[model samples]
Target: MLNRVKRFADKTPFSLTTPNPQEYTLFNQAILYGVLIEPYFTKIHIKHLHAIIIDGYKLFLSLLVGIVNELYGKLVNSGKEQLIWVTKEMIDVSATRIDSLLVCLMRQIVGGDFSNGNLWLCFELVSLCLSKWDCLLQEKPVVLTSALYTFLRLLADHCRVSNNLKPMMLRQMEIEFFVKMLRDQFQLCLKIGRDLFHVPF
Candidate 1:
Protein backbone atom coordinates (compact mmCIF):
# COMPACT_ATOMS: atom_id res chain seq x y z
CA MET A 1 0.00 0.00 0.00
CA LEU A 2 2.78 2.42 0.90
CA ASN A 3 4.74 1.49 -2.17
CA ARG A 4 1.77 2.14 -4.43
CA VAL A 5 1.25 5.52 -2.82
CA LYS A 6 4.93 6.30 -3.13
CA ARG A 7 4.82 5.41 -6.79
CA PHE A 8 1.84 7.65 -7.34
CA ALA A 9 3.53 10.49 -5.43
CA ASP A 10 6.80 10.05 -7.26
CA LYS A 11 5.08 10.20 -10.61
CA THR A 12 3.48 13.50 -9.74
CA PRO A 13 5.76 16.31 -10.95
CA PHE A 14 6.81 18.48 -8.06
CA SER A 15 9.87 20.40 -9.25
CA LEU A 16 8.68 21.50 -12.69
CA THR A 17 5.56 23.09 -11.31
CA THR A 18 3.86 23.53 -7.95
CA PRO A 19 2.42 20.15 -7.09
CA ASN A 20 -1.33 20.12 -7.34
CA PRO A 21 -2.58 20.94 -3.88
CA GLN A 22 -5.43 18.42 -4.10
CA GLU A 23 -3.09 15.63 -5.25
CA TYR A 24 -0.61 16.47 -2.51
CA THR A 25 -3.37 16.30 0.07
CA LEU A 26 -4.49 12.94 -1.33
CA PHE A 27 -0.95 11.60 -1.05
CA ASN A 28 -0.73 12.74 2.55
CA GLN A 29 -4.10 11.21 3.37
CA ALA A 30 -3.03 7.89 1.88
CA ILE A 31 0.24 7.96 3.80
CA LEU A 32 -1.53 8.81 7.05
CA TYR A 33 -3.96 5.90 6.54
CA GLY A 34 -1.07 3.57 5.77
CA VAL A 35 0.82 4.63 8.88
CA LEU A 36 -2.20 4.00 11.11
CA ILE A 37 -3.30 0.71 9.53
CA GLU A 38 0.07 -0.93 8.78
CA PRO A 39 1.81 -1.24 12.12
CA TYR A 40 4.46 -3.62 10.90
CA PHE A 41 5.66 -1.16 8.27
CA THR A 42 5.22 2.05 10.25
CA LYS A 43 8.86 3.11 10.23
CA ILE A 44 9.22 2.47 6.52
CA HIS A 45 5.99 4.30 5.84
CA ILE A 46 7.13 7.30 7.89
CA LYS A 47 10.44 7.27 6.09
CA HIS A 48 8.63 7.22 2.77
CA LEU A 49 6.52 10.12 3.92
CA HIS A 50 9.56 12.07 5.03
CA ALA A 51 11.29 11.44 1.74
CA ILE A 52 8.43 12.85 -0.29
CA ILE A 53 7.17 15.44 2.13
CA ILE A 54 7.02 18.96 0.67
CA ASP A 55 5.04 20.78 3.32
CA GLY A 56 6.95 20.02 6.53
CA TYR A 57 4.19 17.62 7.66
CA LYS A 58 1.40 20.19 7.94
CA LEU A 59 -1.04 18.22 5.82
CA PHE A 60 -0.08 14.97 7.53
CA LEU A 61 -0.67 16.47 10.98
CA SER A 62 -4.04 17.84 9.86
CA LEU A 63 -5.10 14.38 8.71
CA LEU A 64 -4.15 12.97 12.09
CA VAL A 65 -6.31 15.60 13.82
CA GLY A 66 -9.18 14.61 11.55
CA ILE A 67 -8.86 10.95 12.52
CA VAL A 68 -8.63 11.78 16.20
CA ASN A 69 -11.68 14.00 15.99
CA GLU A 70 -13.86 11.78 13.77
CA LEU A 71 -12.75 8.18 14.30
CA TYR A 72 -10.72 7.90 17.50
CA GLY A 73 -13.33 5.93 19.44
CA LYS A 74 -13.69 3.27 16.76
CA LEU A 75 -9.97 2.84 16.08
CA VAL A 76 -8.48 -0.55 16.88
CA ASN A 77 -6.10 -0.82 19.82
CA SER A 78 -3.01 -1.11 17.66
CA GLY A 79 -4.19 1.82 15.60
CA LYS A 80 -4.60 3.89 18.76
CA GLU A 81 -1.12 2.94 19.87
CA GLN A 82 0.25 3.92 16.51
CA LEU A 83 -1.64 7.18 16.63
CA ILE A 84 -0.05 8.10 19.95
CA TRP A 85 3.39 7.01 18.80
CA VAL A 86 3.11 8.99 15.60
CA THR A 87 1.84 12.01 17.51
CA LYS A 88 4.91 11.95 19.72
CA GLU A 89 7.08 11.65 16.67
CA MET A 90 5.39 14.68 15.14
CA ILE A 91 5.94 16.57 18.36
CA ASP A 92 9.61 15.69 18.36
CA VAL A 93 9.92 17.24 14.91
CA SER A 94 7.80 20.26 15.93
CA ALA A 95 5.08 19.77 13.39
CA THR A 96 2.75 22.65 12.62
CA ARG A 97 -0.51 22.95 14.59
CA ILE A 98 0.89 20.26 16.87
CA ASP A 99 -0.72 21.93 19.87
CA SER A 100 -4.06 21.58 18.16
CA LEU A 101 -3.39 17.87 17.76
CA LEU A 102 -2.56 17.57 21.44
CA VAL A 103 -5.67 19.53 22.35
CA CYS A 104 -7.81 17.23 20.25
CA LEU A 105 -6.32 14.16 21.94
CA MET A 106 -6.88 15.71 25.37
CA ARG A 107 -10.53 16.33 24.55
CA GLN A 108 -10.93 12.66 23.66
CA ILE A 109 -10.41 11.76 27.32
CA VAL A 110 -14.08 11.46 28.20
CA GLY A 111 -14.78 12.68 31.74
CA GLY A 112 -16.38 10.30 34.27
CA ASP A 113 -15.67 7.37 31.95
CA PHE A 114 -13.39 5.06 33.88
CA SER A 115 -12.94 2.65 31.02
CA ASN A 116 -9.44 1.33 30.41
CA GLY A 117 -9.21 2.99 27.00
CA ASN A 118 -10.14 6.37 28.43
CA LEU A 119 -7.73 6.05 31.32
CA TRP A 120 -5.04 4.93 28.92
CA LEU A 121 -5.57 8.04 26.85
CA CYS A 122 -5.37 10.15 29.97
CA PHE A 123 -2.16 8.44 31.05
CA GLU A 124 -0.52 8.79 27.67
CA LEU A 125 -1.41 12.46 27.39
CA VAL A 126 -0.39 13.36 30.94
CA SER A 127 2.83 11.50 30.49
CA LEU A 128 3.41 13.26 27.21
CA CYS A 129 2.94 16.64 28.88
CA LEU A 130 5.26 15.70 31.71
CA SER A 131 7.98 14.34 29.46
CA LYS A 132 7.78 17.20 27.02
CA TRP A 133 7.28 19.95 29.54
CA ASP A 134 10.09 22.25 28.51
CA CYS A 135 9.56 21.85 24.80
CA LEU A 136 5.85 22.52 25.14
CA LEU A 137 6.42 25.43 27.47
CA GLN A 138 8.67 27.03 24.91
CA GLU A 139 6.76 26.23 21.75
CA LYS A 140 3.20 26.48 23.00
CA PRO A 141 2.63 27.23 26.66
CA VAL A 142 -1.08 27.57 26.00
CA VAL A 143 -1.30 23.82 25.48
CA LEU A 144 -0.13 23.26 29.04
CA THR A 145 -2.81 25.67 30.24
CA SER A 146 -5.39 23.62 28.36
CA ALA A 147 -3.93 20.42 29.82
CA LEU A 148 -3.97 21.93 33.28
CA TYR A 149 -7.68 22.63 32.99
CA THR A 150 -8.50 19.27 31.46
CA PHE A 151 -6.54 17.24 34.00
CA LEU A 152 -7.83 19.27 36.93
CA ARG A 153 -11.34 18.37 35.86
CA LEU A 154 -10.27 14.79 35.28
CA LEU A 155 -8.56 14.66 38.67
CA ALA A 156 -11.86 15.58 40.29
CA ASP A 157 -13.51 12.66 38.51
CA HIS A 158 -10.58 10.34 39.10
CA CYS A 159 -10.78 11.08 42.82
CA ARG A 160 -14.27 9.61 42.93
CA VAL A 161 -12.90 6.19 41.89
CA SER A 162 -9.66 6.28 43.85
CA ASN A 163 -10.34 2.93 45.47
CA ASN A 164 -9.88 1.08 42.19
CA LEU A 165 -6.23 0.26 41.44
CA LYS A 166 -6.20 1.74 37.91
CA PRO A 167 -7.77 5.01 38.91
CA MET A 168 -5.49 5.14 41.93
CA MET A 169 -2.46 4.83 39.69
CA LEU A 170 -3.83 7.36 37.25
CA ARG A 171 -4.72 9.74 40.05
CA GLN A 172 -1.19 9.54 41.40
CA MET A 173 0.18 10.37 38.00
CA GLU A 174 -2.22 13.25 37.75
CA ILE A 175 -1.01 14.56 41.10
CA GLU A 176 2.56 14.42 39.90
CA PHE A 177 1.59 16.27 36.76
CA PHE A 178 -0.13 18.98 38.78
CA VAL A 179 2.78 19.32 41.17
CA LYS A 180 5.24 19.68 38.34
CA MET A 181 3.12 22.29 36.67
CA LEU A 182 2.63 24.29 39.83
CA ARG A 183 6.16 23.88 41.11
CA ASP A 184 7.90 24.79 37.89
CA GLN A 185 5.29 26.87 36.13
CA PHE A 186 3.47 28.59 38.93
CA GLN A 187 2.56 31.70 36.99
CA LEU A 188 1.00 29.58 34.27
CA CYS A 189 -1.03 27.69 36.86
CA LEU A 190 -1.97 31.00 38.41
CA LYS A 191 -3.62 31.94 35.15
CA ILE A 192 -6.01 29.11 35.83
CA GLY A 193 -6.74 30.42 39.33
CA ARG A 194 -10.42 31.26 39.53
CA ASP A 195 -11.28 28.23 37.43
CA LEU A 196 -9.41 26.11 39.97
CA PHE A 197 -11.97 27.01 42.63
CA HIS A 198 -14.72 25.68 40.38
CA VAL A 199 -13.21 22.19 40.35
CA PRO A 200 -14.68 20.28 43.30
CA PHE A 201 -12.48 19.78 46.32
Candidate 2:
Protein backbone atom coordinates (compact mmCIF):
# COMPACT_ATOMS: atom_id res chain seq x y z
CA MET A 1 0.00 0.00 0.00
CA LEU A 2 2.77 2.38 0.93
CA ASN A 3 4.51 1.41 -2.27
CA ARG A 4 1.47 2.36 -4.28
CA VAL A 5 1.36 5.67 -2.44
CA LYS A 6 5.04 6.17 -3.18
CA ARG A 7 4.47 5.52 -6.84
CA PHE A 8 1.74 8.15 -6.80
CA ALA A 9 4.06 10.45 -4.94
CA ASP A 10 6.93 9.91 -7.38
CA LYS A 11 4.68 10.83 -10.22
CA THR A 12 3.47 14.00 -8.50
CA PRO A 13 6.81 15.33 -7.16
CA PHE A 14 5.15 16.68 -4.02
CA SER A 15 5.95 16.60 -0.34
CA LEU A 16 3.85 14.99 2.37
CA THR A 17 2.80 18.54 3.19
CA THR A 18 1.04 18.54 -0.13
CA PRO A 19 -2.04 16.36 0.17
CA ASN A 20 -1.84 13.72 -2.51
CA PRO A 21 -3.95 14.67 -5.50
CA GLN A 22 -5.66 11.39 -4.85
CA GLU A 23 -6.53 12.89 -1.45
CA TYR A 24 -7.80 16.27 -2.54
CA THR A 25 -10.78 16.09 -0.16
CA LEU A 26 -12.37 13.94 2.50
CA PHE A 27 -13.72 11.42 0.04
CA ASN A 28 -10.41 10.95 -1.75
CA GLN A 29 -8.58 10.86 1.56
CA ALA A 30 -10.86 8.00 2.60
CA ILE A 31 -9.78 5.88 -0.36
CA LEU A 32 -6.08 6.47 0.25
CA TYR A 33 -6.39 6.05 3.99
CA GLY A 34 -8.47 2.94 3.56
CA VAL A 35 -5.98 1.40 1.15
CA LEU A 36 -3.09 2.17 3.49
CA ILE A 37 -4.30 1.43 7.04
CA GLU A 38 -7.36 -0.79 6.60
CA PRO A 39 -5.21 -3.86 6.06
CA TYR A 40 -3.29 -3.42 9.30
CA PHE A 41 -6.35 -3.75 11.55
CA THR A 42 -6.09 -7.53 11.59
CA LYS A 43 -2.80 -7.57 13.53
CA ILE A 44 -1.56 -4.14 14.43
CA HIS A 45 1.89 -3.38 15.78
CA ILE A 46 2.46 -0.64 18.31
CA LYS A 47 5.47 0.86 16.57
CA HIS A 48 3.76 1.00 13.18
CA LEU A 49 0.51 2.19 14.68
CA HIS A 50 2.43 4.95 16.37
CA ALA A 51 3.94 6.00 13.08
CA ILE A 52 0.58 5.97 11.36
CA ILE A 53 -1.29 7.85 14.08
CA ILE A 54 1.25 10.38 15.20
CA ASP A 55 2.80 11.09 11.80
CA GLY A 56 -0.28 12.88 10.54
CA TYR A 57 -3.08 11.31 12.52
CA LYS A 58 -4.23 14.62 13.92
CA LEU A 59 -4.59 16.11 10.48
CA PHE A 60 -6.48 13.06 9.33
CA LEU A 61 -8.91 12.99 12.24
CA SER A 62 -9.43 16.71 12.01
CA LEU A 63 -10.23 16.40 8.35
CA LEU A 64 -12.91 13.81 9.00
CA VAL A 65 -14.40 15.92 11.78
CA GLY A 66 -14.36 18.85 9.42
CA ILE A 67 -16.31 16.86 6.89
CA VAL A 68 -18.91 15.97 9.47
CA ASN A 69 -19.10 19.56 10.57
CA GLU A 70 -19.46 20.70 7.00
CA LEU A 71 -22.34 18.35 6.45
CA TYR A 72 -23.92 19.43 9.71
CA GLY A 73 -23.56 23.07 8.78
CA LYS A 74 -24.87 22.71 5.27
CA LEU A 75 -27.73 20.27 5.74
CA VAL A 76 -28.76 19.67 9.30
CA ASN A 77 -28.73 22.07 12.20
CA SER A 78 -28.25 19.34 14.78
CA GLY A 79 -24.46 19.63 14.64
CA LYS A 80 -23.96 15.92 14.93
CA GLU A 81 -22.84 13.10 12.63
CA GLN A 82 -26.23 11.79 11.59
CA LEU A 83 -26.48 10.25 8.15
CA ILE A 84 -30.25 10.30 7.82
CA TRP A 85 -30.44 13.66 9.49
CA VAL A 86 -28.03 15.20 7.03
CA THR A 87 -29.14 13.44 3.90
CA LYS A 88 -31.96 10.95 3.74
CA GLU A 89 -30.51 9.66 0.49
CA MET A 90 -27.81 7.86 2.47
CA ILE A 91 -30.14 4.89 2.66
CA ASP A 92 -29.11 3.08 -0.45
CA VAL A 93 -28.75 -0.62 -1.09
CA SER A 94 -25.39 -1.78 -2.43
CA ALA A 95 -22.99 -4.68 -2.22
CA THR A 96 -20.02 -2.46 -1.41
CA ARG A 97 -18.40 -2.56 2.02
CA ILE A 98 -19.96 -0.39 4.70
CA ASP A 99 -16.87 1.75 5.09
CA SER A 100 -16.63 2.36 1.37
CA LEU A 101 -20.28 3.26 1.36
CA LEU A 102 -19.58 5.61 4.23
CA VAL A 103 -17.01 7.36 2.03
CA CYS A 104 -19.49 7.69 -0.77
CA LEU A 105 -22.26 8.81 1.53
CA MET A 106 -19.97 11.46 2.95
CA ARG A 107 -19.15 12.68 -0.53
CA GLN A 108 -22.82 13.03 -1.21
CA ILE A 109 -23.45 14.84 2.05
CA VAL A 110 -20.83 17.44 1.22
CA GLY A 111 -22.81 18.06 -1.95
CA GLY A 112 -21.36 17.69 -5.44
CA ASP A 113 -18.48 15.32 -4.76
CA PHE A 114 -16.91 16.58 -1.58
CA SER A 115 -15.73 14.85 1.58
CA ASN A 116 -13.03 16.10 3.94
CA GLY A 117 -12.64 13.84 6.89
CA ASN A 118 -10.49 11.11 8.44
CA LEU A 119 -13.28 8.55 8.22
CA TRP A 120 -10.80 5.85 7.30
CA LEU A 121 -9.09 6.28 10.63
CA CYS A 122 -12.39 5.91 12.44
CA PHE A 123 -13.22 2.92 10.26
CA GLU A 124 -9.86 1.34 10.94
CA LEU A 125 -10.20 1.68 14.68
CA VAL A 126 -13.80 0.49 14.76
CA SER A 127 -13.17 -2.48 12.48
CA LEU A 128 -10.14 -3.53 14.48
CA CYS A 129 -12.03 -3.35 17.75
CA LEU A 130 -15.03 -5.25 16.44
CA SER A 131 -12.67 -8.00 15.25
CA LYS A 132 -11.47 -8.39 18.83
CA TRP A 133 -14.52 -7.22 20.74
CA ASP A 134 -15.08 -10.35 22.75
CA CYS A 135 -11.45 -10.88 23.64
CA LEU A 136 -10.84 -7.24 24.42
CA LEU A 137 -13.99 -7.09 26.52
CA GLN A 138 -12.71 -10.01 28.54
CA GLU A 139 -9.04 -9.08 28.64
CA LYS A 140 -8.30 -5.37 28.33
CA PRO A 141 -11.76 -4.69 29.59
CA VAL A 142 -11.27 -1.52 31.58
CA VAL A 143 -10.78 0.73 28.57
CA LEU A 144 -13.16 -1.31 26.52
CA THR A 145 -15.77 -0.65 29.17
CA SER A 146 -15.26 3.07 28.89
CA ALA A 147 -15.30 2.94 25.12
CA LEU A 148 -18.50 0.94 24.98
CA TYR A 149 -20.22 3.32 27.34
CA THR A 150 -19.26 6.22 25.11
CA PHE A 151 -20.40 4.33 22.06
CA LEU A 152 -23.80 3.85 23.62
CA ARG A 153 -23.99 7.54 24.27
CA LEU A 154 -23.21 8.30 20.67
CA LEU A 155 -25.80 5.77 19.54
CA ALA A 156 -28.46 7.36 21.67
CA ASP A 157 -27.58 10.75 20.31
CA HIS A 158 -27.81 9.63 16.72
CA CYS A 159 -30.92 7.49 17.07
CA ARG A 160 -34.18 9.36 17.03
CA VAL A 161 -36.11 6.55 18.74
CA SER A 162 -38.46 6.70 15.77
CA ASN A 163 -36.13 4.55 13.74
CA ASN A 164 -34.99 1.07 14.67
CA LEU A 165 -31.67 2.06 16.15
CA LYS A 166 -30.93 -1.11 18.03
CA PRO A 167 -29.07 -3.02 15.33
CA MET A 168 -26.98 -0.07 14.30
CA MET A 169 -26.34 0.75 17.93
CA LEU A 170 -25.13 -2.77 18.60
CA ARG A 171 -22.74 -2.65 15.70
CA GLN A 172 -21.56 0.75 16.84
CA MET A 173 -21.10 -0.67 20.31
CA GLU A 174 -18.73 -3.24 18.91
CA ILE A 175 -16.91 -0.60 16.94
CA GLU A 176 -16.91 1.84 19.83
CA PHE A 177 -15.52 -0.74 22.20
CA PHE A 178 -12.87 -1.32 19.62
CA VAL A 179 -12.09 2.39 19.47
CA LYS A 180 -11.85 2.52 23.26
CA MET A 181 -9.33 -0.28 23.26
CA LEU A 182 -7.25 1.49 20.64
CA ARG A 183 -7.56 4.80 22.46
CA ASP A 184 -6.36 3.26 25.72
CA GLN A 185 -3.56 1.50 23.87
CA PHE A 186 -1.41 4.60 23.28
CA GLN A 187 -3.07 6.89 20.76
CA LEU A 188 -4.13 9.44 23.30
CA CYS A 189 -1.62 8.59 26.02
CA LEU A 190 0.43 11.54 24.93
CA LYS A 191 -2.33 14.06 24.34
CA ILE A 192 -4.70 13.06 27.10
CA GLY A 193 -4.21 13.68 30.77
CA ARG A 194 -0.40 13.71 30.64
CA ASP A 195 -0.29 13.52 34.40
CA LEU A 196 -2.50 10.45 34.53
CA PHE A 197 -0.32 8.86 31.86
CA HIS A 198 2.68 9.73 34.06
CA VAL A 199 4.09 12.23 31.61
CA PRO A 200 5.13 15.78 32.54
CA PHE A 201 2.35 18.10 31.45
Q: Once superposed on the true structure, which residue ranges of model 1 sit more than 4 Å away at CA?
A: 1-19, 198-201
Write candidate 2's Cα lDDT for 111-150 as tens digits. 1111233232233334544655555444444433344433
- TM-score top scorer: 1
Predictions: Cα RMSD each: 3.4, 14.7
- Could you tell me how far off, in angstroms, the CA of residue 94 lies in candidate 2 after the best superposition? 30
lDDT (Cα, tens digit) per residue for candidate 1, span 1-201: 556666654442333344588667767776677678778877876776676677878889888999999999999999999999999888878888899999999999999999999999999999999888888999889899999999999999988885789888988888888878878888888788787566544
Off by over 4 Å in 2: 1-55, 72-128, 132-146, 153-201
Residue 16, candidate 2: Cα error in Å is 7.7
The lDDT leader among the candidates is 1
